[model samples]
Target chain A: MKKICLGVVGIVLTFFSAYAQTPQKDSSTYKSRKLTFDEANLVSSYYKQEGNNAAVTGGIGSQKLSDISNTIDVKFIKWDRKDRKHSFDLEVGLDHYTSASSDQVDLKANSSASHADTRIFPSVSWLIENEKNGTTIGAGLSSSTEFDYQSIGANINFSKKTNNRNGEFTAKAQAFIDKVSLIYPTELRSGGGGDDDDDDDYATTARNSYSGSLSYSQIINQRLQIMFIADLISQKGLLSLPFYRVYFNDNSVQKENLPDTRMKIPLGFRANYFIGDKVILRSFYRYYHDDWGLTAHTVEVEAPVKVTPFFSITPFYRYYKQTAVDYFAPYKTHISSNQYYTSNFDLSAFNSNFYGAGIRLTPPKGVFGIQQLNMLELRYGHYTRTNGLNSDIVSMNLKFK
Target chain B: MKLVKLKPKVNRLAVVAVSAVAILSSCTTVKEYQKNKLNDGEMTLSSRKIQKTESSFQSYREGASGANGGKTGGGCGCN
Candidate 1:
């Protein structure tokens, strides 16, 4: 009886130790440990031992996706294996983007929904990831036909793994530089200039911005995971839209604009719920305010469900609304005496809606080939503005693990 | 001019209404959404075990889900 009691006591103590110790995220959850080239019939498990994915997207927005009314982009992503200590992962990717937009419009034409610019952009990105300690770092560069922009960013994060992965904290920052071409006809430069050839001057505008976010992610029991993120952003330099135009003939409005330099802060949150074996619910909200005298808000929700082991579908919806800056007005409203003004629709008071759906498919796991090699996704989206502007979108992503 | 003063206030109310609708819709029992034990994770929220890619989510972007995979390694412009 004494021996039995001792054994029970030992067992009880062991359980208490486990419960008292801070729990940790199990490493086995990563695929690196489970996948083997031998398990799958591949040319050779030897190439780079990295995971890769490619996606192409085409979309339209009230104001061109980039400076063009409609845009298309192809993105390539790859993640190299982590170092021995699992201290960090090396990631790399590229984006090839092209945009075509209509030209500047007068009162006789509707210019709010089109872009008159045609250009191609190429961007490169890199990231370093730390899983065991919960942290990440990232950087990127992009070059466009009219401008070449470079960006560098980084983030630090920490989390708890006990009982459940209940909560986490993160901080992030980013900076960018833009070099734009300044070549235009004399008539296009605020009415007239002596030489149209004087446009060859290139302007290297340094617009730097830094954003800091302190976020907390918590698992409120088993069914829900909620995240709250608060951000502070500061921007300086030429932030105005160059091609936007405003008219004042009888003050018939055609466009709107706001100040170029501003600082902004936003508070946002996201919540995710696991409804059942195959269904998931997500919600997002953000409130934005800037020093340039503009305030905006965004809310989005999406529901995703697995129709089968190999197929999944998701439906998404978003609503955005914003108030115009104190200095914003429809063409000719700015008497030129006002320091800030434009007819750009992007700065005007308006609301919009975005609706979309996605379909995803994956071949059987461990099915003699690469685990992620055969996955594919298709997405379609629609956007509309209260003022008579609308757009459609299509995107596809393919992967090879 | 009087009507213009009311527009801003009206929009704020609309934002609140939208949130209410979302919270309420979440409570409804959709027949297609049935609970599954696989999601419960045996009382623990995270499993450190290296898993099948399909079994776990990849939080690979910065806009919402997070920039890194959270131990799920990856490099992407979104990060």
Candidate 2:
């Protein structure tokens, strides 16, 4: 009887000791250091426009054009030993466009190589975020290529959150070094125009732009948030298109010409408010000015209404107005005595309106029963300008995780 | 005459400054748990991903650009 009791007691003690030695699961301290796939997004859009103002035709011809664009971006995330989060993003975009005005580059030709073109742009970025310090730093490099143009861009950005995490400030600087092909109009070519199909016939000029941006965002309340943004931009080099034809009052035609340097300032504000469980209102406003004697204002509003937790509909509208630049004039309006001149209507005083609607779907299971597909959205917009330009666009986005 | 011309501009600036102060002073310190509505995707204070192409087109068509998280200049949108 005594041996049996001693054995039982020994077994109980062993069980208690083993239980005490086992480790408890604490998720707070366990972060995966390995890089993990975060998400990917694909966006596609088709746009068509019709107008009477075409800069390539001295701002008085068909501005008919159509473009199809697609972009894909993938992101990855990892945790470092210091508990900082690192993110990597890679993006690629392609655009194909056909323009009737560009086809008029050779006035007598029914069709020209400049009528249609394709563009490709790719960018990569890395960001490091320190949770303890509430700070983030990021840098990116981007490039764009087309038959007549090439651009290389670089940017760096930093952001910091307030101690309470209610407000944040960000600053960014960006630069682009671009080369534009000097594809002169056939009649305007100094030497007898070379074959359009020969790339060696064209020379490229440099155009560089630099900008600095600052922004601040704050959570005003549980249902409201706002942001302010400002940017200073400077550009130098050839600012006018080589192929654009400007007709003087005397009926003589020449290529557009303008000053090589410009300075611009733009200030913007954005606000988002949740009206209730079903509706959200987003609004934006901006004021812009440039040293070329251009001033502009823009206002936009959008309201998203949730019909269900997983589905929402959004309606939006925008209004914009701008004053003409000092160098802008209508076709055959410039005189020979003018030192600078352009027939580009985009630089002319005008008002524009854009209205659009969109639908978004995000389901817990998936967008369409595919586990990896997280969200899907579709949108359409119509635009009208006081200068008689009208356009329509349709876009779609798909997100996968 | 110069002061008279600048009067309206000064008034507009003062109004903006006053409104900003009023808005900031009304802010409440919200706890994390009470941020559910503000944390919603639609409530973000920046441009949405779906509006990317729209912004691009607008920038190209308009004389004014930048401060909207879109390209100020580059890549030649010369259609």
Candidate 3:
């Protein structure tokens, strides 16, 4: 009986010790309160266009232009004491372009200083999201600067999710204050002679814009989602480019003129659907109208086919049509009696088609075997307008984590 | 004659309204666990980052803008 008792005691001790050594369940969820690095994206694009409708030259000159643009954005995230997530995004963009039409601003000079310019834009945004409440608030400030134009922009946005997390509503307000240099065509300049390179020598005019937007997104099912968006935009102050020449029926040339105030409304819808296991279809439609007597319609569609777990190809097409604004006319088609006149073809009635294809690669090991490189995408598009304008653009994006 | 002219427009609008209602009514509540396909990057309802420049140029080249998460009227695109 003594031996049996000892054996039982040993067994009980072993069981107790094993049980005690087993790791206890952690009842508290751990979240890092410190700010953490999230991800970064680098985007680059090259665009070139050729046509004969140059607004600067009274809509009848070389409209060739080429631009190279690059932008980088970095993001960081942190959790506050209230368990709300805060995210910060900083982005900077640069663009350099050479336009054959801008050279005509001098009219008498070849390859003038106005032919090439560079622009830099930078923005910073902060967002706070409450997971428990499924709400987010964000604000951002942005600025853009070039030789003849400067713009400052600000925006605030808020979003809330439905109880079931299947739908979300978002609202945003934005404002921009801009300054445009009153640089006129050489022949039309009152003084007839000024240093083209001295941007400060010219007078500047203010142009301000404000807009309010609302959007709602709903998940139709496990494989499909849709969104509806609408915006009201208002602009006041200088609305026309001073360098854009307008030639009247009598062949008299003057600077383009437009109303000082404009209002616009745009309504849009987007739908995305996943088909089977390998394809996704995305579609968008927009209807736009403005007090300037311009009405437009846009439709876009894209299909992405997944060839592998890590690779996909997307093909897209877009159709856009717009009616001429009240102030718009072709070269030498305007009458001097009109209060507002412009020869800018962009404001004239036209239709355009844009088509493109893109490839994306996201390997498990990372793109190009670099663990930090999360994805790489390359895309090319061709755009053609019915009024004899054609352009091509190539874009690339790289994401790092 | 005027009524006949307006009849087609009314029919078109009615068809659009009915289609939208049908689509919305068919929506099913999807749980988070069943959102694998919905979570795909390509399934996003917004414009892709790669289309930023495209959107910029379009806003400049075309008279119509806004409602696409892009700048409506800010900087001068006079080039």
Clashes in each model (backbone N, CA, C under 3 Å)?
A: 24, 0, 0
lDDT of 3 by residue, A1-401 (tens): 23433453354334334434333322248655777656777788889999999999888999999988877787878889999989999998878889999999989889888999988899999999999999999999999999889999999999999999999999999999999888888888886334566657878889999999999999999999999899999999999998999999998999999999999999999999999999999999999999999999999999999999799999999999999999998998899999999989999999999998999999989787866678999999999999998999999888766
Cα error, residue A55 of model 1, in Å, equals 30
TM agreement with the true structure for every prediction: 0.59, 0.93, 0.91
Cα lDDT, all candidates? 0.43, 0.87, 0.89
Looking at model 2, residue A346 earns an lDDT score of 89
- Give per-residue CA lDDT, model 1, range B24-77, as digits (tens): 445423221332422432222221111111111111101122211222112122
lDDT string for model 1 (A128-212, tens) is: 4555554555555544342223333334433333332345565555444444233222234453222333434334445455556
lDDT of 2 at A160: 100
Per-prediction DockQ, in order?
A: 0.07, 0.80, 0.78
- Please report the TM-score between candidate 1 and the true structure: 0.59
Which residue ranges in model 3 land beyond 4 Å of their true spot? A1-30, A192-197, B1-14
C-alpha RMSD between model 2 and the true structure: 13.1
Give lDDT tens digits, candidate 2, residues A79-159. 899999899999888788899999988998778788999888999999999999999999999999998889999999999
